[model samples]
Target: MPGTTTLWRPTGPAELDLVAASGWREWPPRLPEQPIFYPVLNVDYAIKIARDWNVPHSGAGFVTEFDVDTDFVSRYPVQQAGGRDILELWVPAEELPEFNRHIVGTIRVTHTFPETA
Candidate 1:
């Protein structure tokens, strides 16, 4: 079956950077070669993983856009005593099932804080 497009909350700063750096200003980009890491509670660990796997030519890990309106807040709640904000990102249709299979899926995720109170 064809995969459905959906949005998921990224787990850390590294995932966030990957999204930003993807240059996907509009509707996220399709990451073919990239491998996402999921359930990544630690932003630092995510960053380190990105740094370690970031090849000069392959581009960052795979990222894409969701067809439906995502409920990021409901999916990933804020952690660390309100020091951070929780958000979700796009997961490719092709790899959705496999991504779910893994315990801590290797999907890219990022965190962003609100500017205003």
Candidate 2:
């Protein structure tokens, strides 16, 4: 806990605004069709998703950085596919606040997408 630190989430601009407006405390509720909240492990993966996926479709993409208790995060499972280096947790909508409580600081938008094209 001493040296260990933050996790990052890549999302659309709408979600970032929601996080900011909610007093930097909670994540917005997931839509009916959406069941999981994914906070990726690395900025590169986050940026890739934000740029290639979120920005093109949503018109605005954002990467959010925050600190969470690694112990709390360790309680969940991590998903990793073949070559993606996409380590992430699948936090269910109902458990979001529980996850949020571990977050140490205000989630800030680290990057905005479409740096080109």
Please give, for residues 2-116, the per-residue lDDT of candidate 2 as tens digits.
Answer: 3335778888878878898888777898888888888888888889889889988788788888888777788877789445697888899889978887787678888987545
Models 1 onward score TM values of 0.26, 0.88
Model 1 lDDT at residue 36: 35
lDDT of 2: 0.81
Per-residue lDDT of model 1, residues 18-84, tens digit only: 5456353322223567543233334554344344444222345322222222232134332443235
Measure candidate 1: CA RMSD. Answer: 12.0
In Å, residue 55's CA in model 2 sits off its true spot by 0.9
- Number of backbone-clashing residue pairs for each candidate, in the order shown: 17, 0
**Model 2 residue 56 lDDT score:** 81
lDDT of each: 0.36, 0.81
Q: Candidate 1: lDDT of 40?
A: 33
The candidate that achieves the highest lDDT relative to the unseen native structure:
2
